[model samples]
Target: MKTNLYSSIIEKISSDKFSSIFILVDENTEQFCLKLFIKKTGIKSFNKIIIDSGEENKNIDTCVSIWDQLNSFKADRKSLLINLGGGVLTDIGGFAASTYLRGIKFINIPTTLLGMVDAAHGGKTGIDFKLLKNQIGVFNDPLEVLLDNDYLKTLSKEEFINGYAEVVKHSLLTDKPDLTFNSLVKLDLFNDSEYIINSYSLVKNEIVKSDKYESSIRKVLNLGHTIGHAVESYSHISDEIIDLKHGQAIVIGIINELYISHKKFNFPLRDVVSVKKHLKKYFTLIPLKENDMENIYDLMVYDKKNEGSKINFVLLKEIGKPVIDQIVDKELFKESFVFYNE
Candidate 1:
């Protein structure tokens, strides 16, 4: 276990305050990460709960199953649930732990780069509803989070690249004007992951501290999420489109929203072009069809961020300076989809 990545959990585990310890894992994590976790931490005695992987399983059914397992194992309020997987696992696992017995102590041991950089650290835990991304969730911080870069080595190139989108999002949100196309320009993965995860993930944590419930400033963190989520939802339902990973949809969301920002707020076109150019190297242009536009648009119309009838978006005047809760016209939102396709 990396000293810096661990928290007081190690000592707490040793102290025997919890009634029992449970490790939650998805199918993928159980196969790939479980052995390494036990070997490294020397924590051999714990109940293991395994769920199927993929965003589709992030629903009430799975939550019920998890709750059932916890009940079967006789988990108590003092019991600890440690989530050992990616975003899907952490989201549903955290949500389960929070709701079960009116919230139990849970820790996040994220095994994916995306989970490490974005999902695991933030207190936002959720499961998708009716294919809408993160439609059901609560803001509850974990007991602790463990980030080990060694896990990144287990990911395939595509899985590794899936997380790059968030890293790019964090860079654009930072004051650093020099932050350009982070991994696209060739970054040494494990060697630089600590600095990248620490710095960029902190950007989210600071914002979250200010607005944990997303009632105000936290909305800025949803920069690409508005449209990104709709895209993700569409992928879940549509036979015409292949499934999109969360970060890939978010990448599309960033591009589309940036177009709206430039059109509405006079955000620099040069910067927009720079972002598109750099992101193009990694994220391909989404194959959005003309017929699919209506479906996608309808999804955004019912998006969680919308204020009654007016759809809300986060736009930037420049990198790091975000204007939140901007009411974008429904027509304009459609235009962004067109702009993204262009």
Candidate 2:
């Protein structure tokens, strides 16, 4: 399906003429995106389903609630669900829509930068199970994905930075030298929204088209996610009141994984330093205690990409070159954190 196209989304929805429409949003998007969507698109009749915002809410329980709402509203197969929010809202809403009545038409209106660049385009729809990220999901593409940069203006600096992490990942994966950290920092999402979003979407779409099921080349997209998901889950499960946002945790993952690349693949240390320096501008290091490392490692073992006891990683051989399914020793995994600390 075509992505990041605003006009096409409106055209498609108008043409579909569905029996009913439903909009799923969190508390955040209800305030920001839904209003603008209503005003701009002149779509006034959809039922509104607002959930609480945050990673904690992306779960089976939330899906059940959304399902109950759809049932109560008597939404049919012809109904269209428009998911409007950040990653959390899109993930859960997509899962809910895909499952309801054996599947209903759905669209994604990504309100956050992260959602626009990463979560909205991918056909992967999922919710976290037992605090592991995307443990339960289906490969279901939305009928259309609408990206409007105006929604990004409502995001706080931290939320914007969270999305920027995925952009950095996209840059690292592609051969785009112009998409460097320095250039990204100066980018005005409002003015350059089409170029940036479409560029990232093109990279992801090309990769996904090759490995739709993530068996081989697609695993390269999981570059920072192995350790990143663990760190994110650890924060959620830990007693710490402050949870790490997905992009914040990912930046940490990117740094330590780059260190692992340096140790295992002899990737250039200078490049690692350059990446770390650029990332540190947006995120502070999350100090991992020995116990935290133990917990995080435990979480990594449950990664969906693993086979039996072996923990597979996608480490970079060089900038823009990712080697997937590399198994790192446990001791080196532990030592990588030490390198990150330094």
Candidate 3:
């Protein structure tokens, strides 16, 4: 925590506004980020609520465990819960803080690259349900979001790539970036972590300011998620398929959706190919059985974004120009996946 960043967060902690404060962490964050945070902020006393790491642990069961911890520790509504990990930590921590004793104040100190750029802000706290992504969740803003690029140094390459996917998405969504999408994707995340993360945070925050509940403009944020989430869900259930990071799956969704965009909206074919070629270099390819289209299709049809039988997608007329609420049939989806595999 830098001096300027610490001023506001420390103000909240030092103030008598809360009866007590609690810090939340998963195993990875506890080992890597906890002490650094404690020493940096100089908070002498607070409760720790530790839990298992990974998306598999992000569910009602975990939420119950968190609630149990808070109850045992005597956390009150006034207590501030500081979630100090990646998306999984913030997702469940925000949910726990929101529901326990009918909502307590919470702050997010996102650790991973993905967490900083996408998961930490936006007030979307959630857990996966019924093998689907973000099926059960709430929209509750945190008291504050603290950012520090120091945490990016602790991430593994795979973890960094998980967030870089969103970086690519945000860059594509905007027409005027300081760096072009090609230059942006090719740059090393660690070398440019501060600028990249700040750019993404600004883009998401700007969009979220207009549509807090994702009614209109915010839907543009889901450009890759419609098909991406379905693939992520499919990976979760399949024994043969390795689990995909949220961003990796989203990258797949972006590539395939670009295919759909070119076919339906005539978004330049060369742009689509170039994006697919570039992103694939960063992410490991997800293996799907040749006959797995129906399985993935079923998952897509069940996507929360879909209405009735038709699946809604956010396609691009061009980079930074998203067309939302476009309904497409299953056959086109199958073709998009085919394009992705190539």
Best by lDDT: 3
Where in model 1 is the C-alpha error above 4 Å? 1-4, 176-191
Q: Give the CA lDDT, 0 to 100, for residue 122 in model 2.
A: 69
**Ranking of models by TM-score:** 3, 1, 2
Better by TM-score, candidate 3 or 1: 3
Report the Cα lDDT for residue 100, model 1: 99
Residues 54-166, candidate 1, lDDT per residue (tens digit)? Answer: 88899999999999999999999999999999989999999999999999989998888899889998788989887677889998999888878787788877887788788
lDDT of 3 by residue, 154-271 (tens): 7888898899888888877887756557568767777788988888888888889999998888998899999899988888888777888899889988998889999999999999
Where's the lowest-lDDT run of ten residues in candidate 2?
1-10
The C-alpha lDDT values of all candidates are: 0.83, 0.84, 0.87
Ten-residue segment with the worst summed lDDT in candidate 3? Answer: 177-186
Q: How many clashes show up per model? A: 0, 0, 0
Candidate 2 lDDT over residue span 140-161, tens digit each: 9998777677788888977887
